[model samples]
Target: MIYAILTEAQNKQEKQPDMADTVDSSIAVAGLKAAIRVASHGSFLRAAISMGVSQSQLSRRVAGLESRLGQKLFHRHGRGVALTDFGQRIMPRVQSLIAELEAFDALVSDTRAQLSGDVTVGVIPLVSRHLASSLVRRLQSTHPGIRLRMLEAYSGQVEEWLSSGRVDIGVFNRYGGARPVYADPLMRGQVSVIGTPDHPLFRQKDIPFNVLQAIPIAMPARPNSLTDHILGAAANHGISLNIALEAGTSSLIQEAMLASGLLTLSPAGTYVKAISNNQLTARHLCSPSVQQTTWIATSRQHPLTAASRAVEKFIKEILYTSTQ
Candidate 1:
């Protein structure tokens, strides 16, 4: 019965020429809004302040709407304003229009909620520990209905996940090495040599690359590691990199750097908290620092789910805000 009534009303509204004409007038609601608000607030200055617009601009907009309506909507009384009879009559419809807009906004929000679905995110080990945890927490907290699955693995494994349909999105770091097919720069981060505070080179102003390369460093294995890029750079400059430990996991690298006093490079954004906690000392890599571009890419065949999009948006926002 309700559906029939709604359909009849919709058909009737569609047939009415006045309703079609009002469509253009309704489009001007935003401009008419200032007039309605000014009339309600009793002062253009107060309405302007409330709306975050200049008083003159608000007055002009309201006046323009009044001109279009061919009616004096407001009377300028000393120290304040009052709605004219025509303004008073039109206000109920204006209020109705505002309520309808709110309803429309709410409908969109609900539709987005209904469209949201589950997503499995494949994150490289390097960023998973630092960015993924917080990102997951934010997503779960904000959208409790969204189901998220996280696959944490080595960078090469992450690439495989991206090639396969195993994950919707993959986050990896580009260190001037083998480029991923669909990757783009999501954020730029520094990969700096970190060590214990008491390490010999910790207090030094500018440690020569040659002197630094002689020290044993804990680095990630090649094929897709930022450490590999650092090593390649050193080699290009005719410096031999003396790596004491090779690990597939960033956590393992951090543990080894802390326990064995071997320098390991880490993204500054990820490691800043640890640096602040005095767990590690971040020093600038000599001459040319190892800089890396962190990226977010979707699998070629996999379409992104709403949950995945939300998580991606959150990550981009957090990274942008933190970097700023």
Candidate 2:
């Protein structure tokens, strides 16, 4: 019996620490939360109410934090609170840690309930607005407590953020054939030549790059951009693209093409329903066509929380099944 008890103890010691084992510094979280609540809400009473603590208790927490840190976190006004410069400087980090801890708790709860936790996914506006929303919605419905933070940014910006540890997942077109640190094929589609329905070029089955180049076009600019990819592909084929505008948003680019009869290269999905509605005309930009692969990227160095991993799996499964 003693040997059996010893074996059980050994098994317990061998077990890995789960989500609850990782959390914000206990000393920091209490005061940091109080300061954040005070700074956000202004009034001590309100902050106290939100924290479910008395005003005196909240003040003591902040005061104790200031004593420990050797600096005051908030500037007390007659009836409100404001973050000091010191407080402001540390707030971003505090918020990030808090978010991570909250996510960790959700992960623990999910593990207990056999559900999944939250995932913060960063994506370019084009992809996030059109593609990932469905996946996000589907994950939310199926997984219940799974939280999703959808960060909308420019494609280039998204890549930078992914590299910097700001996001757990990213979706973007693979620009310039450069591979991400870790990637899974999300989807692949061809770039199409888009023009207004009434444009003169719309009459042709397909126009050569040279002819298309003669028309003023709107395309994205340099530094590993989707627009840059399209223009480079055209240049490689010995065609000069006359870009009249470099717009940031797809809506703007499509509108420009509609208003000015300018040409733009876009993914097949970009014009799917619009072309069907006769709002625009799209032809596969071939001879050979410019094709791009959309990929879901994650940091191999930063392991996703279990809940995040679960949601990622669900997203990939759904996307894969849909394509198949």
Candidate 3:
């Protein structure tokens, strides 16, 4: 690149020393994006899939980046690849660069949307565990230009994120008066008793809450939606649930049951695939049939970007259809 006429013809030949550096800089942007995707997803295949690009193309980009840097950026092993020492050192800078680039694009695009931007979404833990990968695939396939940053938290935290404008979207409970956000009903999911296939309770078509004490099933600790529902129902029935373990999260509750050969309570959709795989069973209660209505919500206080709206549509569609 030149702004003025060169003083001598020798100046052209002198630029040869910087030729490799010029070439490296030219290819660095694409390679950086590829490397970031691979690092974020922890799998080259998943990164490629999410980016809607070929795996070989992504691999070549990363390889080109490594060649220019003169070091291995990743360590290949049986399970997956991990960033090497050099890669770790530069990852923060790389991420910052990517963020800056995104902001620049957003600024330049202004009102005219390319429908390309990042959205931070808060999802309930059980919901995240169940359909995160599926949702990712859907987004990748449908709105490949939109980038998702998922934050898995409890219902309260998800609401807080929405209210505070910390997250662009959230999956939260639907019912509540004078809410701080705009919530669209997604679907109802059953609150169930999770147990192994061998359990005698499996034979029952509809297991009642009164039978909870008979099997010593664990429920979530208080200060949660599921536990509050169960406790209220138990009180109404004049039955005290003999809690074996007061687990913190849904995953912990399930883990406690699996590790100790105990039973636990969870959302029906949380283990749909597991149930089919003969890994667990989710039984809905009969006496008090409980289900939670989920919503795809965005903060009323926070205006949404075009990318966020696109994601909101995708989330609502995938969530309801998957339940059916």
Candidate 4:
């Protein structure tokens, strides 16, 4: 009965196209968006701050929304709130509807207008320095009106940002399996085996993965994408990695490689400058090359802002051009 009624109402809405109805919906739209912001941030205070409103106003808006629906939308705790079962069921639909409306507005906006907005992009820590430099320089030159915030975080945190609607776009190293989110494969992160030139493995053209068990290496500590992959691969290969040094920072790991004859696995960009300066020797990992597919991820929950669209377009072009 509910399904039938909803279908009929949708059909009627599609056919009638009433301007007065749209005007009437403005208040509901405001309430829905206010509810969504709170849900996404998980705290009324944080949501209000993000929305540039007061906590009391945010609470009132959500309370009004709940009153209209005649259902409690949140289970409030001291620290934050979680969506009620009813809210969980409808939030995705509301988010999608809002995204569609936002996209429509963007489509009808001035075609030649300068893109001016804040866009937050999350990137895996390994790619942060390289991508941030290139992206900031290009955006500054072309889309001067756009403000870009680059967040360097682990892949898990980046994924959380996407799901929570915090980031406009993000990059992650695709490993283990494909994620249950929208992603575009930007490039494969080339993994390399590195050692100082004086080391015995320095002359190698290609390094076998299994040899890592025997090599003294400096590796990243926990909460790193590369470290996770290395550990996984080690487990699968039934080999114990000879991790001589475990460092929390990449620079520290690099220092271990430089100070000692410790071989290490690194992304191509990590040691490219050092390799060019005759300080290190590197070879692509062979026998099933150690590599990660890098992806540009976006949330289905929100439409890309004009600034985000421009940034995404530029990044796609840059990634494809580099691959070519």
Candidate with maximal TM-score: 4
lDDT of 3 by residue, 1-324 (tens): 111111121233234537665454545666878888899778899888766579999999899878867888899888778999988988888777666665554555444646677888899865786557877887787667888899986676788888788999999753223232246677776677788877888798878888875567777666666677777778988878777888766678667766776787666666566677887887787677766778777865566887887677777777777778
Q: Candidate 1 residues 208-254, lDDT tens each?
A: 56677578988777665676677778988888878898887777878
Off by over 4 Å in 3: 1-111, 129-131, 138-145, 174-181
Q: Which stretches of candidate 2 lie over 4 Å from their true place?
A: 1-117, 129-133, 175-178
Report lDDT (Cα) of residue 188, candidate 4. 71
Candidates in descending TM-score order: 4, 2, 1, 3
Note the Cα lDDT for every prediction shown: 0.70, 0.69, 0.72, 0.75
Best-fitting candidate, measured by lDDT?
4
Better of 2 and 4 by lDDT: 4
Indicate the worst ten consecutive residues by lDDT in candidate 2.
1-10
**Residue 32 alpha-carbon offset, candidate 4, angstroms:** 25
Can you give the lDDT of residue 217 in candidate 1?
Answer: 87
- Which regions of candidate 4 fall more than 4 Å away from where they truly are? 1-107, 110-113, 176-180, 300-303
How much does candidate 4 score in TM-score?
A: 0.62
